[model samples]
Target: VQLMLVNLASPVGPPFALKTVTPSAFIQNMLQSTEERLNNTTEVNPPRILEWFDMSNTLHQKFSLIHMERPLFQPFPSELVFQNFTPLQTYKLPLILLNNDKVLRHVKLEQQESEDFFVVGPVNSGSKVAPGMSITFTVGFTPKENKDYEGRLICVTERERFEIPVRAIGPRAILDFRDEIFFPICLVKAFTQKTHLLRNIGNSQAKFKLHTQRPFSVKPSFGTLDVGESLQVTVSFHPLTVGDHREDLLLHYHTGEDVFISLCGSCEELDIHLEPECVTLKRTYIGLTNVHTVSLTNSSDTTLQYCWTMWPIQEVEEKNSVLLQEEKEEESKGQRLFECESSSTAAHHYSVQSGALQENGTTINCFYIFVVQKGEIWPNTTAQFSIVFKPEEAKIYQHTVYCDVTGRESNLPLTITGEGLGPELELSYSLMDMNNVFIGDKDQYDVQMSNVGFIEALFRFSVPDTTFGRCFSISPVEGVVPPGASQNVKVTFQSSNLGTFSEDLLLNVNGQPHPHTLTFRGCVIGPTFHFNVFELNFGDVAFGFPATLTCTLFNTSFVPMNFSLRVLGDGSGSQSVSSSSQVSNLSHKNWKGHAARVRPVEFTIIPAAGSVRAMSDVNIKVTLCSNTVKVYRLALVVDVEGGQTLQNLCDPALSSEAVSREGVSFLHSQASIDADSLRITLHLPDKEPHQSNS
Candidate 1:
C-alpha cells in the first residue's frame, strides 16, 4: 500500500498532511508536486527576526529569534529591555535589527505610549530594510514622573510580526556647581569670605554636604537643592599665619558624587619698625625739659594702625638711709614709682611729655599715650614723634615704649634714656683776712669752695679793678668741683704800697643764679726796725762769774737810723756807767739831766746804741753777772730815732701802745724805745753738791 503526507503552512490547520497514492509512479508525481509547492511557499514568505542590538553597541539575546529548535517562551512580555533607566526621565537608544533575508522588505513600528519615545531618521513609523542588512532606528524615551514604565513595540513585516519590550525610568537627582575652584587673598588674623553657587539641574531635589580644611570654613555646609534651583554657599578663610595657604572644599551629594573646589589664598603680616630703635635725650637740668624724636615706619604691604605707651620709669633712690627705707616699703607692696622730696613734700622724680592730635587740628600735651590713627601710616611710609623728658632730680633715667596694633598680637619695643642735672655751689668762708702785711711782703688767704648739689660745679674767680685787685692774686682762676667735694682757692696779697685795703672776691659758679662773694681785708706797712732775737738768755752762769752775749738789731727802714741803748736790771742796788754813755750825754746836753737812773748791776750794755745804714744790721754786746744762785732778768732798751718817716706812712689805727713796746714798731716820737729783756740763771755749781755726796 502507498501513503502520502502533506506539510501545510497555513495558520488554520495542522503542520503535516497525509494522502493515498499508487506505489512508485504516484509517489514520484506526488513528490514533484510537493517540491513545487514548497518552493513557491518559500519564495513568498517574509524575512525572519535574527538578533537585537541597543545604542550601547551591545547584543541582547532576550528578543533573539534565532533558536527556533528550542521552546519559544517569552520570559518578559516586552522584547526590548532597559537595564538601568531612571524613572520620570527620557532615555535615548538606537534600536537595531540583524536581517538575514535575501530580499528587501518594508517594516512598521507601533507602540501604545507613542508620546514617551521618539525615533530619528526616515525609519520612524515605517522603514525599508535591505536584504542581509541590519534595520537600525534611533528611539528616544522621556518620562514624566518617577516610576517604571513597560510597553511593547510591534515591528510588522509582510507575513510576520515581532514585539520589542520598552522600559523607562523617571527623572533622577543631579548636583552641579558653577565653578570648580576659587582663589582669595586674606590678611593674617583677618577674616575673608567668598560665595560659591551650587546648582541642581535634575528634576528631583538633591542634598549636598560641604567640607574643608583648617582655617577654612564653609557656611550652609549641608542643604537641599530643589529641582532646577541654585544655592549660594559662603566659604570663609581665616588665616593664622603668613605666606601662601591652600585647602580643599568638597561638596558631597546624596548620590555618592563629590564636587571639589580648590581654596587658595595668601596671608600677609603687617610690620611696623622704628628707626634707631631707641630714643635718647640729652642731659637736661633739673626742672627743665629735653625733647627727642623717634621715627616709625611701616614695612609691610598694607596700612597699619599703631599705638604706643611708655612704661613708667623706675625710681632711682638716693643712697641716703631715709630714702632706702622708703624704697623697701614700696618694694614690699610690689609697686614702683619715682619719688622726689622737696621741702618735706613728695614729688615725682621724672615726667614724660608727648604730643597728641586733637579734633580741631591742634596738638595737645599727652603725658603717656602716643598713637597714630587708623589709616594714618601707609605702606613704606614713615612718621616721627617727639618725647620730652623732664626730671625733678639728678639721675640717669631709662624707660621702654611699646607700640601695638589695635587687634593684633604683634608689638614693638623702644627704649628711652636721659640724664638729669642739679647744680649747687657753696663757699666755705664768706670772708678772709690776710692780717698785717708789710710793704714788699706777700701773704695768702685760703678760701674753700664746695659742690653740695648733685652735679659738677664750675667756678671762676674775679676781682674788681681797685687797690686790692692790684695787690691780691688768686691761685685757681677757674676750676671744677664735683659733687660732695671741696676745693681750696688761695688768694695772695703782695704789694709795694702801704695801706689798709679791702676787696670782694667773686665766684662765678656754673648754673648759679647769683655769684658768690668773699670779702678780703689786709694791711700793708712800710719799713721798720726789727730785732734778730727778742730776748737774750745766759743760761747757767756760775756765781761770781761774768757772761757776755751779743744781739743783732736790723734797720728795715729805707733811711739811715741812729739808735741809743740803755740797760735796766731787777733792782740789785748796783750801778755802772759805760764810756759811750758820756758821749751820748754830750750830744743831747739839753736833756742830760732828765735821764732816769735805776738799779742795773747784773747786766750791762758795752756799746750803748749805734748808727745803722738803710737795710743794714748792728750787733750789741751785753755783759751779765750773777752773785747769787737766783734767776735774774734785765731789759735792754733801744731807741729808734729816724723811723718817724716810715711811721707816718703806716695806718694809725693799726698801731697800738702795746705794739710799740716790742720790736718791729714804727714810732712817731723823736726817740722810740723797744725794751727787750734777758734772763740769766746761776745754779751755784751742782759740782759742789756732787763732791759732798761722794
Candidate 2:
C-alpha cells in the first residue's frame, strides 16, 4: 500500500507548520517527478519533512516545516575610523566579521576604488565564517594629503549584504612664515626681540621645532599647535660685536622635513650723549680767538676716558677726496688751473706777495683749533669743555673735532664752523696805460684806495722781480686806510730803457687772503735823430793821397745828444792769429772783402766828440787815405751817449734798415748806451770816381 502527499490548502495550521495544499492529479504527478529529480542529485536531500505511517491498506502522514531567519555576515564594528595617518604611508587596523546565524557562511568585502582607505585580508573573493564564529580582516588606510577621508565597505554574503562606513584621520603640519626677517638697530651686548605668529591651518595637530645659532635664540622652540590655532613665537638677538649680523633659522617638522628662514640685524656702538653737539661761533676778525662751551654726558655704567683730537688724517683725506672730486667737476666747467713748482722763484715771490703764511709764526696743523679740557668722564655724569677757534685766515673755517673714548666702538665727531672777516679795499684805477714815456723821465699817477669793509685796511705795495716791475715806485708804500675812507696813492714810473713795458703791481693788504694786482702798461721812447749820409764813397786816389768828405747830422728830438765818431777796420788784406786761440783768423780789414791786395786804409774825423743841439743839424767831416791801389771797406761808427737816435720812431719804413745797419760786425762797445750806434760804410774802390770824400 502507498500514500502520496498532494497539494493541500489550509488557512490555519498547527504551530509547527502553516501551509496551503490542494489535491490534484497533475500536482501529484509534478511532486513525484520533483522527488525523483532530487533523489538523483549528489547533494544530500533535504530532511524529510513528512513521515508516512502504514496500517493495513490505510496510510496516515504528518508534514512539518520550520521557518527561521537567514544568517548574517557582518563586520564587528559598524563603522571604521583610522586616526593619525600620515600621507603616502600605510596604516592598518584590525576588523572582524561575525556570523550571527547557526550556519556556515561565505562572505566577501567590496569597497570603492580609493587611495586613502582600503581593506586587506582574505576577504577579497570569499571567506568562510562558521556558525557562531567570526572571520578577521585587515582594514588599511593610507592618506595622500592632510585631510579627513570617508569611505564605505560592503560585507557581502550569499543571503545578505552589510555596509560598514570607513574613515581615516590624516594629520599634517603647515607653517606660515616669511622667508626673511629684519631687526632694528640695537646696541652691542643688548637684547632685542621680535615676535611673529605661528599657526597650524591644517586638519589636525602639527608638531614643529625652531633652531638657531649663537647671538640668536627662539622662545618655545618646539611645540605643538591644534587645528586652526595660532601661537606667538619670539626671536631674540644678542650680539657681542658691533657690526652687521646674519644667520638662518631652521624649522624642523615631525615628518623629517626642514625649512629655512633668514634672520638679519645690526649692532651699533655704545650710547654716549653730547649736549650741544655742534659749535658755531660768530663772525670774528682774523688773529682773534672765539670760544664755545659744550658738555659730554656718559650714559653707560662704566667710566670712559676721552680725549679731544683733530679728525684723523685718513678720514679727513677721504672726505677731502670727495670734496676735491666735486670741486674738480665744478672747476671743469670753468678755466683750467696749472700747478706751479714751489721751488721756483716766481712761486716764492707769489707766495710772499699773497702773504700765504702768518707773520712771525711757524707752520702748525692745529693752529686754528684749541681744546681746553680733556680726560675721563664718570658714568651718568656730564663734563664741560671749551673749544677755542683761532682763525688765521680771512675766510670760512670748518673743522671736525673728534673725541676718542674707551668702551666706544668709534670716535664721536663734532663740527665746528666759523667765518673770519677782514677789510675790503677797492681800487679806483685797476688798469693804467701810460701812452708814451720818455726814458730817464718820471711819470706820476694818483689812485684812490677806498676801504668799504667794516675794519681798517693796512696795505703795502710791492712789485714783481722783473725789469718792467722795478720801474714803478709807489709813495707811502705802507699805510692804513680806515673804513669808509679813501686814500690817495702816488705811483711813479721811471724807466732807463726803451721798449714796451707792462707789469702788475701787488697790493698786499693785512688780513686779506690774496693780494690786489694793479696793471700798468706803457712804451718807453728816446730822442730821435737822423743823418744825411748813410755811406761814404771815396774814388780811387794816388798812393799816400788823402780824400775828405762831409756829411750832415740832424737831431730832431726835444733833447740834445752827445756823439763820438770813430773808424773800424784799416782795410788791410792780412790774416792774424788771436792771442787767445791757436787757429789763424782772417783779419778785420779783410772781412767780407771782394777785391785782393787792398792796402791799409786810414780814416780821420774832425770834431769827433761833440753835441748836436735839439732840432738842429751838425756838419761832420770824414777823411780817408789809402796806401795801396785796392778796394777798401771800412765802417765809421758814431756812438751817442745821452739819448737814442730813434730814426725808426719817426719813419716806420726805416725800421728794418736801421736795425740791420746798427748791427755791424766791426762796431763793438763795452759801455751800455741808450741809443744804438750809427754805422756808415767807407768804400774805396779801385776805379776812379767823379767825386771825392770832403
Candidate 3:
C-alpha cells in the first residue's frame, strides 16, 4: 500500500525525495499495527515466555524448563526424553502472566492427551512487560529407586490454552509423520531379515501398500496407551534377495486415521495404553478363503509373548485340524492365537503347503493343515488341460484330447456346439436312414447325441471324418439346444454321380474343449440309380456275325426309352455288312428288340470307301437288370480290295480287315487312312491271297 501511495502521490512512479522505510522499523510498526488490528493478539496479551525453571537432578542444578513460542495448533513437532528412573508421578508445568503482580491470565500447556504437540502462546513474546514464569513439573523420580524414567514433551508454549497435536506418545506416530517433524523419541526402525529377490519384493509391496515405505517387518501398535500400560506386537517380513544383512527401517502409521494406536520402540519394555480396551476381533483376514495360521513375530529388539485367534474355525474339528511341523502346533478350545515371540513376525507357514491353519487360543503360536475342501477346485473329469496351439502340432492330434470341465460341486450337464470340427465326429455315423431316395428327392438325417449330464446342453457340430465334397456345408455354424434337446439337425444333400456317397457333419459347443466335436450323418445317392449295371463289359464288340447275348435291363433313369435295335462294331462287323452305292435315300428296317430271333446276315457287303460303323458307341445305353449296361458285337469277315485303312485305331470293337478266310491282324490296312473321314476306301480280310492281282 505504501509503495502504491508513493506512486500515486508522485505520478511519475515515485519521487526521488521519498526514501524507502527501514526494514526493522517498518516491521516493528507493522507488528504494533497488527496487534491493534487483532481483537486481542495473544502474542501481546501478556506474553508468557519461560524465564526460569529447575529440575531435582544434581548433574545440572539449573533445572531449567526452556519454553519458546511458535505455532501451537497442528500436526505439531513432537519430542521425547529418557530418564534413568521411571517417573513415579507426573506434574503439570505452567507459565503464567500477571497484571499489577496479580494473576490476570495463564498461558497454555501441552499434554500427551491431545495426540501430538506444538508451540503457541507468547507468540510475540518479550514484546510485552509480563513477568515470565515456569513450573518445574516435578517428575517424581530419584536416583535411589533405580528403574527407567520416560518423558516425552512433544511441543511447547506458555499457558495461553489452545489446541495442539498428538506426538511423543510413541514411535508409530513419528514414522507416520516422519516426512515433517522429528519426534522426540527413539522410533520404529525396520530392515530386511531373510534373503531372496521374490521375498524382498514382498517388503517393497508391504512398504508402499501397507506403511509409507517404512520397513517395520514387525509392525507393532499399542493396545491401550494409558498412564502406564505396555503392549507388544510382532511382525514378519520375508526378504527375497539371496544375501545376508540388516537395513535400518522406519515404520509409519497414524494413531488417528487408520488405526487407533501408535508404535513405539522395542529397545526397552515400554508401557502402552490403547483406548477402547477390547475389540470384537483384533485381527482378521477376509478374502477368498479362511485363516491359515497365526504366529507371533517379533522383529524388534526385545523378546515377548503374543496371542492370536483364527477365523471361523468352529464346529468341524476334522476340517479345523492344525498340523504343527517344524515347531509345536495345537488347537485350543475352538479359539486360536499366537504365543511365541521373536525378532520377526514372519511365521513359518506349514499350512501353506499343508492345509487349513487354525489358531490356538492366543496371539503367540499357531498350527495349520489342508482343509477338506480346497479353494479353486473343479470336478471336471472330462476337462482337458493340454493344448497343441501350434500348426506343426495340429495335424497329429495324438497329443491333443477332448475334455469337458464340470463343476464337481455344480454338476452341470454340458453339450458342445461347434463348426469346422464335429465331435463323436471321430465316432461313426449317427443313426442311418435306409428307406432310400429318388435321384432328386430330399432326405432328412437324424444325428443323435446322448447327454450324459442330467441337464441338457448345446453340442458343437463339425465333420472330422466320413468326408465332404464341395456340395456341402453346415448351417448356423453353432446351434443352441437346451439340456436334453436331443433334436435332429436335418442335412440336405445332393448327388452328382449315380451312386451312394456317405458323409459326416460335426457338432460342438458345450465346452467340449477347443477342438471338441459331435457327429452328423448323411448319405446321398445318384437319382436312386436303377439299371442293369454302371457299365457293360462286351469283351470286344464286332460286326455282322450277329453275336447274341441275352440280358435284362432295369428301369433306373426314371424315364422310359424307345431304343431302336441296330448293330455296329468298332465298325468292323457292320462295315463288312454293306455300304450302298447310292446318293438317294436308302431303305432300312425300323428294327426294335422284343425277344425275336433275328437271322444272321449271309451276304458279303462292303462300303465303297471312307465310312465307319461301331457296335460300341451304338451299344451305349443300359437298362433293365441293375442300373448297368451290357453290349454285344460279332466279327464278320469279308474279302475286299486293300487300299488305305484307318490309322492308329485302338477301339477293341473294331477288328482289322481280313482277306479270304483269315481274321485281320492289321492295325491299319494302310496305305493309311482316317484323315478323319469315317469311310475307308478299301480294306481286306488279311491281304487277299493274290494281292491286288486277285
lDDT: which is higher, 2 or 3?
2
State model 3's lDDT: 0.26
Q: Which candidate number has the best lDDT?
A: 2
Off by over 4 Å in 3: 1-443, 448-456, 464-470, 473-478, 497-504, 514-553, 557-694
lDDT of each: 0.54, 0.61, 0.26
**Tens digit per residue, CA lDDT, model 1, 481-520:** 9878999988877675557888887888766556788888
lDDT of 2 by residue, 337-454 (tens): 3121212122112212322233222223323333332456688888876666666668887766665554444556677788887778999989999987756556789989999987
Candidate 3 per-residue lDDT, tens place, 34-106, comes to 1132222122121222342222442222322323242222111111222222233332222222212122222
Which portions of model 2 show Cα errors greater than 4 Å? 1-269, 273-283, 293-295, 299-305, 311-372, 376-384, 454-458, 479-487, 528-694
Q: Rank the candidates by TM-score, best first.
A: 2, 1, 3
Best by TM-score, which number?
2
| Candidate 3 lowest-lDDT run of ten | 400-409
